[model samples]
Target: MDQPVYSAAAPRILIVDSSRNNLAVLARRLGAEGYRVMVAETATTALGELQRVPVDLLIADLALPLMSGTELTRVVRRELAWRDLPVILISGRSEADGVVRALAAGADDVVVKPFHFEVLTARIARLLERSTRVRQLAADNATLDERVVRRAIELGEARDRLKALEAELGRVG
Candidate 1:
């Protein structure tokens, strides 16, 4: 575990579960955990929410209506392939195979049903911290790349000027 930790801002988490009670409980609890929480009862609504909002992490149920969380994860992975969006798929205790499949489909973690809230929150925090760090690193890398390009251009211009001066010295000498 690389153990990415300690983000500067509270992360926004998106929860997708078909059960209204589950959604409500998760939203309220995560909100209290110093996170901005958004809930969607179905994968489609979750997709819409994803499009409109910038979510740090996603917690989705594996057995969603119409579209399973595995499928949702695949779609999200395809669409936001470049981004470091972490996904956790909650599965029924019976679905070991689905958990494996969901992981293959790009879910970062899996929580079997009847999970401890503490465990879920810990996972959320870790993923959010990692995402924040990855984004920051990407930004820093872009800045460094820009600086390198600028320096290369300046060096090229100086090399050209040096060559012209050498040619003039050759003719004068």
Candidate 2:
């Protein structure tokens, strides 16, 4: 299936799974979809990679060799730089409770095993769009804050000038 091309820089995604087969398949699929894919066999490796590189999104298996996906999600959410990063948990367990727990632990979305590639791709696109919007809004807010500060300074100077003019008028009169 043909995927939409993102801007000049392709979005980067980190996928963590203990299963080698799952890692190979997902890496191939996401790479074909125009994403720069990074794969890790364990949560520890994933976290290490995150420190060295900037990842736009994370896709982790719920069952990791050491740490669970939910725990990883919580850690990511706690980090200031990664707090806003989008995470999707993929689990072989079809239980609804697992999905609920993953979301509660701060996963942006959960996908059951044997999920369609198309569906996963769509979800990734939606999350990336939302993240982009949030970043843009933050930048706009910073610019607005600078403008407000500048205006306040100008107003204060004007007020001082007005007071000085009033004092001069009193002396001349």
Best by lDDT: 2
For model 1 the TM-score comes to 0.90
TM-score of every candidate relative to the true structure: 0.90, 0.91
* Candidate 1 steric clashes: 0
- Cα lDDT tens digits for candidate 2, 91-124: 9979999999999999999999889999999999
lDDT of each: 0.88, 0.95
Displacement of residue 51 (Cα, Å) in model 2 is: 1.5
Measured on C-alpha atoms, candidate 1 has an lDDT of: 0.88
Candidate 2's displacement at residue 70, Å, is 0.5
Off by over 4 Å in 1: 1-8
Evaluate residue 153 in candidate 1 and report its C-alpha lDDT on the 0 to 100 scale. 100
Candidate 1 positional error at 75, Å: 1.2
